[model samples]
Target: MRRTAISTTVLALTFLAVPATAQAQTQYTGTNAPIKVTLTVQGPDGLLFKGKVRTKGHDVTPATGGTHTCDGTNAGANPSPVPTPTAALDDAARVNGFTWDGTWYASFDDYLVESVKGVKSDATAYWNISVNGTSIPVGGCQFKLNAKDTVAFTWTTL
Candidate 1:
């Protein structure tokens, strides 16, 4: 068999085996145990929150600035988000020993973490969320975390 053809077949099989994200359940099935992960919140001032946190849930308030475009343009009209488990970065960030704030963006169906500790996103800087040192296209609240995932919210600029 040709090398290119063999690789193509293998790649196709891998895609077929991987379940869709919306339908897939995590490895820890049927268990409500908190997803413990390392969380870091770095603002312009300095590191605000750094420690392990629980992704099970939190009593903190939901992001309240209506919505924002991917480019950080606020949508102006705040819509009350339906209560649900963001169950990802937002869930884990609820702890880490710092007060966090964010706003829900319907455009992405995720929460854009706006402020950490006392530092807030402004015309000059914003919170950039990364997992394992890589920036992802989706919002933190949408990105599922595995155990030991290094979730960092670093202050960034345009």
Candidate 2:
């Protein structure tokens, strides 16, 4: 009986001495933070349009709607804003070395389709854009315009 007690005490002590193999497990890494990119488009006027594009991995929130600050030169310029498109074409023309002149559509069908034809200063690419966001992808850049990138365009009414 004494030997049995001693062995039980030893086993208990051994078990107590052994550190608990399982502790609170925590996941402290491999988290992705959200990314935001702003794309501003201006025409003959100042601050034509501004958009905010945001994305996390494959999830993206394209531009839904925004106001356009029509210049005095534009007809019926009374803050007659329009619906913005979810995405715009980031087109580049080859003639002027990567000049961007792309076009963007609006969420509302009535709004005039924006036609952008300019040179992207940052990339030096000439582009010709139309209403729909359609263009050949270049520079391994996926044509995924997030919600943060505000896009705008202007044209003289014929």
Candidate 3:
């Protein structure tokens, strides 16, 4: 009984010594405390992917989405407003996106999808983004996301 009491006291002190910021970090860690969301990728032929993916809110990462041909490398990249781990294009890319091609447009400080799942955007047709069935004014990388939100990418024409 005496040994157990001493061990418990030490454990309690160790936990108390930890800083508040460090304990809170787990909530901000994208993979550690993830948020669930819906992702829908609609191709010209049909739907490419639809499922739930885990994501997190974060401080805006400039020019971030992936490490592909056109991801997170713009000279004019700027961080978006901090909301809970944003589930924009970066989340889709992390979850179920494939073979994506996008451009980090410094003019808009956003990312535009040029191709995804082998489908390319043409002069007439392009990939558009909608959150919960409403079209977004900003690029996919700039759009914010919330839990249970449905992010849809549809291939369409002007």
Candidate order (lDDT)? 3, 1, 2
The residue-by-residue lDDT of candidate 2 on 1-158, one tens digit each, is: 65345433432332234333311111112222333545444554454444444433221121233333211111221122212222232221122222332221222111222234432212212222222233211110112233344333322221
Model 3 clashes, total count: 5
Q: Candidate 1 overall Cα lDDT vs. reference?
A: 0.49
**Cα lDDT of model 1 by residue, 1-158, tens digit:** 45335433332332234345522322222223456667777778777767776664223354453432221111211122211123433454444344567655355444656666668776556677667797543434433456667778788874
lDDT for each residue of candidate 3 in 15-120, tens digit (9 for 90 to 100): 3354555334322211224557787889888988787777653433323244421221212122323222123445666545355666544554444566677787
Candidate 2 positional error at 117, Å: 13
- The models' CA-based lDDT, in order, is 0.49, 0.27, 0.51
TM-score of every candidate: 0.58, 0.22, 0.59
Error of 3 at 117 (Å): 0.6
Would you list the clashing residue pairs of candidate 3?
Answer: 56-85, 57-84, 57-85, 58-85, 63-72
| TM-score leader | 3
User: What is the alpha-carbon lDDT of model 2 when measured against the actual structure?
Assistant: 0.27
Residue 18 of candidate 2: its Cα lDDT?
Answer: 31
